[model samples]
Target: MEKDKKIKLGISIGDLNGIGSEIIIKTFEDNRMLEFCTPVIFASIKTMSFFKKHFKSAINFHGINHTDQIIHGKVNVLNVWKENVSINFGDEDVKIGSYSVKSLEAATKALKEDAIDVLVTAPIHKHNIQSDSFKFPGHTNYLAEKLGGKSLMFMVTPTLKVGLLTDHVPVKDVPNYITSELIHEKIDTVYNSLIKDFRINKPRIAVLGINPHAGDNGVIGEEDDKVLRPTLEQIKSKGKMVYGPYSADSFFGSANYKNFDAIIASYHDQGLIPFKTIAFGHGVNYTAGLNKVRTSPDHGTAFEIAGKGEADYGSFKEAVFMALQIFKNREEYEEYSKNPLKKAPKKS
Candidate 1:
């Protein structure tokens, strides 16, 4: 955590059957990435070598059996499993899914134990990763339980940010899930994250309507007038800069989102659809409100282009940079805020 020390970045190799391995090696292939953070990949060195040869990458790695042996300025592959598992590039094997879970479990443990300062996860296929031990919808929900905070699925870029009220929830169930408490909790999470994570002093947040035109004043539905409007009013009464139940259909088309620090959507697709459309391949899916820093590329595993070596590493690379920046931002926020007169560290 020292200012001069590089952030220890932990990586969980997502579904090997997908583009996870390909993008990971591709991102670290440029040795210059090591100058920002010490990368520790939570998969076997042999597995990484197989990927390196398949992708024809010239990236070298520092192999280690444990995290304690991690070396800075090297792509360290900590041996999570020793057996050589067969890989089918585009096939969805449940066994391959288990390996992704193993990698995530080990990397999360390291994060909690302070072995790593931040984590950038590759994309995981949601269906393949379901098991008795790991029965959450996705990483955000699972990490929420593990890290003990009201985790928010915040999809962000430098210019735009969108948070979800209900992620990975079915559309029919989204309405029932939106309650007064959920609004307050989600807005509070976004407000705090903008300040501590992004250095925004006073964040102005806008909420999207749950129903069309926010229920058209009861013509379309009653939830907007009865549920969303009242809840936001209560938040505003508390002296927080919260606005809307704006029509979801026109909010982005009119570029209204640019007016606020962040937007809270009523459901998953309502938010992610616009976010990815605007910032695909450049956005980072950041999990705000968690005690630990976690981020992933905006896109998912591209099964169609799994082994083609045609996958883009821009988002994955951005995820790494965003995690490191947020980690430092949180450190600096704490350092200066905790002590009124703490001297700023000198730049190198």
Candidate 2:
């Protein structure tokens, strides 16, 4: 796995019309970022140049047509193609969608072929990016299918870690999807991710209730008691430190999250609202349970701020660092898991 060498971070250049190139350029402008890993952005050099005209940065890059040409300590861009379409920022054009898919497909192919060590994806406009080849809600679903594993949309920050039981679904449909089996699968993914990716020894997790006020003891809803609580009980009895069915509203207000390694939210907003509120500029959306490491900035494609030189690169930079760290941690964890110490002979 090239454990001794510096990591090669494969990046997908989200939507060409968005602020992806801006943030990516800003993140790698300082030479300090290169010391940890080599950044190979999967995009066209022309799109990068367009963004460079808007943002004033000293970020220089090396253009290559193939992944094998990647060089350490440089912003190596593997241009997917010499894009023929005219550049137009902030518009959701089909041309942009096709090119974005090319970037994603190429980057993912590199990841699967072991050409790149980790992947830090940029944001995409959901409506425009949909096509015959891509039919999932977002990156998490697409990655899960390609990478082969149960996907868990985990939002991570320094203080809090939140995983979703159900992701990228409608608010009304959330209840029907949250079954005991789904809870077990998501929580198990979180527990293992904490141990291997984040390097936590024992990951104690909390689950937020599905109903308001935790069903108010069934006065508000029935899922909290009938489904969630019983499932958690079984999980705890089976040797995992899992707990909850706690009221979601008050859970984050009191900062009770500090007491646990991670929290499992019933749906998207129930977890993301508080997380983005606290760590919007730096939060990382990590797709756990995938065979390979993948992470993204918490925010979406900033169409309004495109080419304005005002895009914040904090979250994107954090995503890169997070992916690198996870790659290292997983390597160490796998080696540790593979071999155990032998018992010494008893003294007479």
Candidate 3:
């Protein structure tokens, strides 16, 4: 494929009982998405038929037998499985969970083989999907393991981009996982991703403190002062524009976040709470530092409103848009990095 050409995207239909299929149908309603890339959904034709009948969507569905049959401006589904699963709205089924994982595995295989330029995943049910066969925590860890374990989950919005040092872990065990080496690795990953993947020339990053009031100079806790500060200093000395140990409570409200390109949060909630508050229906949960571009909707499987045709598709749309943008950005960066001073015209 040409570097500047429209990239092919592989879409994985998540939990069938949830709002995954519904949102995927709703998002393709916009014909303009076809102008950017060709989307190939790794799902069953029966599942798409079920959603079309249930939701009364007007999308034109095409059952693709081969990858060459993928067409833009249409929903192209590669039926990987012959699942005769009947879905109940808001109901949990192990069969649906297994199907979701199967679709993910297919999409991941395409990504690894370079068949797809990017991967846009729908929301999956973590609790329902948990099994002995799939012992990973969630999509982040699962993708990490599949992609050789070099991945970090970061929730991105226009206002605030928050990267979690540790994701999907208990709050009590968070402190135990906090180490200078871990912080260094996560921040390094985020910083390099900003420049390489996102195409930011000079990335400025802000790291949040672990404890309340930023440890109040070691009064409440010493982790911020003892661990994070020294790491920040070492990173700063290495010529990366990073500043941190900021109090999580006040940092969200302050305009200082806009000064930096990305925020490295201590844990999951500390980063997501403010990110969702500002960009609830617009946030894109991107798994950065991976070899390939991967993005998902920040929201989860809204099983309560699954088949009612009432689930909001805003986040899912943003996730798709983000994948397209990042794919293009990475391509541009790679081209420019290879040949500096090329002076390409700006894209509209």
Best-matching candidate per TM-score: 1
TM-score of 2: 0.95
> What are the lDDT scores of the predictions, listed in order?
0.92, 0.87, 0.85
Off by more than 4 A, model 2: 1-4, 342-348
Name the Cα RMSD for model 2.
4.0
Candidate 1 lDDT, tens digit per residue, 1-348? 666788899999999999989888989999999899999999998899999999999999899988899999999999999999898988888899999999999999999899998998998998899988889888999888888899999999888999999899889888899999999899999999998899887789999999989899999989999989999999999988999989999999999999998999999999999999999999999999999999999988898899899999999999999999899888888888889598643321
Candidate 3, clashing residue pairs? Answer: none
Whole-model lDDT, candidate 1?
0.92
Clash pairs (backbone) in predicted model 2? none
Candidate 2 per-residue C-alpha lDDT over 250-313 given as tens digits, one digit per residue, 9 for 90 to 100? 8988989889989999999999999898789999999999999999999998999887778899
Better by lDDT, candidate 3 or 2: 2
Ranked candidates (lDDT, high to low)? 1, 2, 3
**Candidate 3 Cα outliers beyond 4 Å, as residue runs:** 1-5, 344-348
Candidate 3 local distance difference test against the native: 0.85
- Decoy 3 TM-score against native: 0.95
Best prediction by lDDT: 1
Residue 151 CA error for candidate 3 (Å)? 0.9
Candidate 2, overall lDDT?
A: 0.87
